[model samples]
Target: MKLIRGLQNLQRAGIDSASGCVLTIGNFDGVHRGHQALLTRAVELAERYGVPATVLSFEPTPREYFSGERAPARVSNLCTKLLDLGSFGIGQVVLHRFGSAFAQLEATVFVRDVLASQLGVRAIVIGDDFRFGARRAGDLEMLRREGARLGFEVDGIASVCAEGLRCSSTALRDALAVPDLTHCEALLGRPYRLVGRVRGGLRLGRTLGMPTANVNLRRQPALRLGVYAVEARALNSDGTGGEFLPGVANLGVRPTLGLTRCLLETHLIDHSEDLYGRLLEVRFRQFLRPEQRFDDLSALSAQMQRDKSDAAAFFASKSTGPA
Candidate 1:
């Protein structure tokens, strides 16, 4: 699948060349079940119309862009979302940069200039509640009217609901607070993942006889701080592929180390390698416990051993998929 970053990349690929593409536009943050439903419809439209299926999402999402500070914690970043989209068979993804200018465009102008003229969208797919453009005047009705005017089709799928609740990125965020992977998988159509580059650490884990690879995740608000049983993967140094390893991780300020910033430290079971500057993507399979200050190093070590045992057991009990 091709990744189109920003307008220049789109122009370079000749967006005007793809005259009959079916497009879906949204943040698509978690790519939750609702999103999956929407994308599935888009793919069907693409098949019916014999056009490329494309997703038009934004970087920094509209919420994050408008927020004076960083937006609330994200459920999934762009790379992970792209990977998930690939698995779902999306043909191409055009990442538009959402900002004041793009946000300020009137609904009609957005549909005419962006979706129709620029992207050549033969059809558009969105959730029933999706809104966009100039204080979000672009509703399903607006999209339908515009589709009629521009000779395009519109597909507005109802939000997917489960167990008397709506499936959404926001709802999934709340579920992740409980570190609930079962509910998360149900909503997300897969496990919740946190990904980032592995950076150098203070070696506190090594001092305690359990070394860890530090992963710097994208800053997210409402991130649960705790110890979790996880499945971890690192890109092979050769850049050829990834290696998955069962692991336990801690997400906190490391009160034991006198640290005050949230960080993820993971210990891969039965493997040791120097990974000072590599990307490590860890999927939280289950929440084992909350972060706590122990009385001393001995106590912490004992608890870590127990955590290791529990993580190993959890991995053993489940299929060794991408967590």
Candidate 2:
């Protein structure tokens, strides 16, 4: 997929920036089922207009930029979100950077300069809740009114829902907080998975006889801090395929060491190898126990062994889909 960095690239590439695409804009944080519906409509429109289908979303998301450290946990990082877009057959994305400067642009100027002149949008499909521009003044009415001037049309899709649950990034994050992986799969149309490159750890797990792959969670973890039943897999260089390993993962600060930083520490049940620098995918299956500081290393090690046993039992009782 082609990544449209910002307005400059969109301008330099001329009106063919995205081949005069039909587009939609949103954070699309998790590319959940609701997003899938929106993108599907965009694709259908693009095919009807004989132009490319494109997505315009923000980097650091508007929520991430404004909320800073207090920002909600991210269900899928940018890379994962892009992958989800590609899976839906979208080949271009307008990844606008949301910064102090960009946030100040007037509503019409943003549409005229970026959406119309730069990309030559054929149409814009957006959600009912979408808002944009300086102090968040933009809305669907503004888009349609400006569409008269810009020659593009606008369509708003009703949010998708399942089993009375509105499919949304917030709802997905909430499911993750409960660690209802099954519900996440329902909302997202897939299992909830965490993706990151494995990094070297303190080797303490090895000393405790449980070698672990440490993953740096790039944002506040959505799942509650706990021990969990998990299935860990390494992604190949081409970002496809890996050996599935039944495992247990701990997501929290290593409280025993007084480390305040949160981390994902996963130990494969029967496989041990150096995984530093490898891209790892961990699918959480069940919440095992809340994170806590033990009285001593002996206690902690013993608890880890039990966590492993629970993981094995969890796997035996349920398939990898979710617990």
Candidate 3:
């Protein structure tokens, strides 16, 4: 998908920024069912107008900037979020860097300079609770006022819900915290997944006889630190290609190894190819066990063996517990 990084990038693109376009704006953190619904509307409008549907979002999302380490754990990183958007068939994306300077831009300037003049947005789709600009001044009312003079349309969508709960990034995070991914999968219409590039690690898993491919979790994580029954996929393209490989994984800091930061270490069952520098996706099928410190490497390695056995039994039986 095409990306317009910021205002300057959009201005320099040489294409008519004011050309007919339908747009949507938000963190879209998880790209959950709710976000998908809004994006679908924008795409439909774009198709009706013979224009492109563009997603306007921010990096270092507002919550991450304001709350620092206190921000909610991200449900999906940039790589995953972009992939999900692409699956919805968005034409392009605009990632605005969020910082102190960008934060203070006046509401009118944001509407006029960014949404109106720059994007030439023919229509915009967003949630009813949406707010934007300095000190949270922009809202549905602001969008309507600007649309009146800007020759564009504005739409505010209601939230989507499942099991009496609104589908939201926060709700997904809460579910992952419980490690109850069954409910998460229902709300998301798919498994809760973490995708990232595999990086070189200490090779400690090899020593334990369960070699792993290490990847970054991409935020101050909200998911519990534990072993999980999972499925891994090796992408053959820019994360769109799918090749599933069953696996078991541990997402946590190795307290026994004295590592302070959490990492995801996954061991693919029945396959071992060099994964360093490649992107892979892991889907949480179910929670297995909590992480704990062992008396020695031998003890930890033994526990890992049990985890492998448990995962094998799960897949072999093809049994999914109480619905």
TM-scores, all candidates, are: 0.86, 0.89, 0.94
Which tens-of-lDDT digit does each residue in 120-202 have in candidate 2?
89988898877889999999899999988879989988889976989998898898888787899899887777777888879
Model 3 C-alpha RMSD to native: 2.2
Determine which window of 10 residues in candidate 3 has minimal summed lDDT. 11-20
How far in Å is the alpha carbon of 124 misplaced in model 3? 0.6
Summarize candidate 3's per-residue lDDT along 84-150 as a digit string, tens digits.
Answer: 8878989888888899988998888988888888888889998999898899999998889989888
Query: Once superposed on the true structure, which residue ranges of model 3 sit more than 4 Å away at CA?
Result: 14-16, 319-323
Query: Candidate 2 overall Cα lDDT vs. reference?
Result: 0.84
Write the residue-wise lDDT of candidate 1 on 1-323 in tens digits.
Answer: 77888865777875674565899988887888898898899999999988889998888688978885756787765556777786677888998788888879999998988888888899999888989889888899989998998899998899788666899888888987877778888887667776666788788789888899997656643447888888787764322246678899998887876767778899998889776787677778879998999888899999999999988888888875433
Candidate ranking (TM-score, best to worst): 3, 2, 1
Worst 10-residue lDDT window for candidate 2 reads 10-19
**Residue 178 lDDT in candidate 3:** 92
* Cα lDDT computed for each candidate against the true fold: 0.81, 0.84, 0.84
Better of 1 and 2 by lDDT: 2
Q: How high a TM-score does candidate 1 get?
A: 0.86
